[model samples]
Target: MTATSASTTSAGPAGVDVAQFADVTASDASLRRFLHGLPGVDQVGCEARAAGLGTRSIKTTAKAQALDLAIRMVDLTTLEGMDTPGKVRALASKAMRPDPADPTCPAAAAVCVYPDMVATAKDALGDSGVHVAAVATAFPSGRAALDIKLADTRDAVEAGADEIDMVIDRGAFLTGRYLQVFEEIVAVREACARPDGTAAHLKVIFETGELQTYDNVRRASWLAMMAGGDFIKTSTGKVQPAATLPVTLVMLEAVRDFRAQTGRMVGVKPAGGIRTAKDAIKYLVMVNEVVGQDWLDPDWFRFGASTLLNDLLMQRTKMTTGRYSGPDYFTLD
Candidate 1:
């Protein structure tokens, strides 16, 4: 979709300031009209562009640099029903020192876990550069009441989470209750605030797989950005077809257009289905070509991954030794 300069920074559709869009939650029709009016996605064209970007050749020193950058941009994630204190600690350690054998490897951007594990993760990552991120708002399914969702967010923030990855109410969104979804995000964003005056950054997940169309992905991206999302994430990593290149491409285009219009930069995270160093580099290539060098840093981009870090470390090891290493050589996440 196209974003006009007047539409970006100062006000979104119908004179709503994107930086402070929480005011528009009163009307669903206004939000719906604004979202549906965004540029339609050409699915074939979008997929072709993603495939073309996937073919980029990165090797030698360039590959090495990409590997390190990808590592630093990872949100080393461990979201499972059986997640435990020990598992969170081990993952937190991995986030801090991805490659225990190599002191030079930088830490992952954050450690993403369930809200219940936020305190454990925060304590485990004490004094480390890595941030603690917790998934909230009923997590994979946004089927709970607004008060419950806000409570979920507050619990994580109170537990010392630095970031909150929240899933939107997909049922409401798909049913065309756009304002309901928007207000939910605004409420969650408010709950991210702490008594100390600092606030946890909010990453809103669209679960593109369920959205089922590039048009919906584009619309959702803009909706979240306008609603004050710090980052617009592709998927929850629990759904099928999570984090595909085409979905991510649509998001990157949205962010680029959004920034051009409002001068506000929103981060993008492609969670799920992204494995291997090659896949990670392909995504990085797409980001560079689509969003440009401005989003290359971890602060503006992230990969929500659990096993992806080990693969990156393995590739980084190969780049250093000129020989491929086995999975055993790297610590399991």
Candidate 2:
């Protein structure tokens, strides 16, 4: 329950003290026992809490602040097979200046794109303070071999990605091969290391929809954190049932508890299906309540979304000018 729990003095991935989890990751059997031993989620209670939080209202000034915060939290993203360099450049531009009409609009947290597009996004975002995040490790599916996955991550980091979002092997996770998934995450985290010795922040995607149970979600959250993931993400945005409130609640709890026990903080990102200012506000409230304000900043939380930015801008405009802006006022992602 503490960082000194393990007797070994070596450090693990992500600078976690190896001794803290020496017993837990000693072998596949030990990892399975430790993960399976975690407390099971109370499905009914979790959903009820999420629904209750979703109903809380913020009005006028508070709502205005929430909208701006949501805008800043967005990972303005585009990941499609047909995505072109021009489109990525446009997205990067939008990320740096979400609302051309207003100079005060805080830039989005980052522009998320495929590995091959990282350079383009990096070029467009150029010193704007908006990070370029690339999804690697066979993103959305994660069906490739470990070597290929590491290579995918290295390519992204080499291409100037400020962050690397790698998908976990959900199949291995579901089959209870906890160590395989853990090792792969560790490998990808290592691949994120840059020549300057600073590593690109690593976000491990769970694709929670495929994991099929709240318990598995909790286990995966702990597993990724133990393996040195800077962030534990809810989905790759390519799967159905992505980023549900209850699932995110479970993950938030995991990070809170992990920090309590290990003194290391891990971020949570709920990607996909969050499309409105109201939805983003609900998540903000949840993060405040479930993990405290420590995770409220863009550095600690993110909305992996495309359309969500437009809604935040619209709400922000309504608050500032007392009128609704048409969707045409914003560029469609």
Candidate 3:
């Protein structure tokens, strides 16, 4: 195992309970076998596909291309707080429509709006095949009570969200309240689980910008996985000095290590500040080199971008015809 640098934060969160999770029992033998079973190209296979992949960093660049199925998880921060239920619904519908001129315009993974807009999104996506994801649990700043957070999660799911993105109590985690952070995630996971027999994917955002150290990021990733994060994400995009390559590398390796120990595949998403095709590709390459190419699929990887899709469309258009395309051609509006 690669040892990470020591954390500079003074042991995240106060009084967090850590020993309550059982998923930590997932052993290395089981995890390694599971990772090997997943499909992917090896170093040689990567080399073979690299030439056709279009970029020298095929591992990285491939993400934007494969991201035809991406979900732009955006916050509906309506000005003047004017989003009535109906207006919120319409906003979500508009957010999900993809550009047909682009071959990559399959369907978005979902329209991630506010909790109140989930039902609207669920209705908007309809049989149209997109999912409805909501950011819950005192989002942007997870400073609410446990009950309120859980209620926030339940309300979003009840409102028809297919998935939930919850913020980890960074204060708790940074203060070494790992156990409290773990418990908060576990409660939300339990609430989000389909008691009616369905299951919802949960993406836990570490907001790596605040963790301040690769070691802490690595430790936090491990804790989140142990507590049951279906996907581990870099930031909420609300933090400054957003998603950096080095921080993402730390998170990716944590996923790799978690898979090595748990026999499960946890996804990774680098949100916030990722606005260019090149930036998206860099994340793709990091996953390829660190986690292996099998995770190249949409199921194992995701990008929480707003402006990223447009840049990718423009780049793809330019590449196909050998010329530049106007920005208005791919308006995310």
Candidate maximizing lDDT: 2
Q: Write the per-residue lDDT of candidate 3 for residues 176-215, one digit (tens) a residue.
A: 6666776678788877865575657788988888987666
lDDT of 3: 0.66
Ranking by TM-score: 2, 1, 3
Off by over 4 Å in 3: 1-97, 102-104
**How do the residues 1-333 of candidate 2 rate in per-residue lDDT, one tens digit apiece?**
234434456654446554567668889999998899999999999999999999998898888888888888999999999999999999999999999989999999999999999999999999999999999998889999889989999999999999999999988999888999988888888888887767899999999989899999999999999888999999999999899999999999999999988778999999999999999999999999999999999999999999999999998999889999998999999
Q: How many backbone clashes does candidate 3 have?
A: 19
What is the C-alpha local distance difference test score of each model?
A: 0.87, 0.91, 0.66
lDDT, model 2, position 329: 95
| Structural similarity to truth (TM-score) of each candidate | 0.93, 0.97, 0.76
| Model 2 Cα shift for residue 152 (angstroms) | 0.7
On lDDT, the stronger of 2 and 3 is 2
TM-score of 3: 0.76
Clashes of each: 4, 1, 19
lDDT, candidate 2, at 24: 80
| lDDT accuracy of residue 325 in candidate 3 | 85
- Give all candidate RMSDs, comma-separated: 3.6, 1.4, 9.6
Residues 259-315 of candidate 1 have per-residue lDDT tens digits of 887678999999998889999999999999999999999999999988898889988
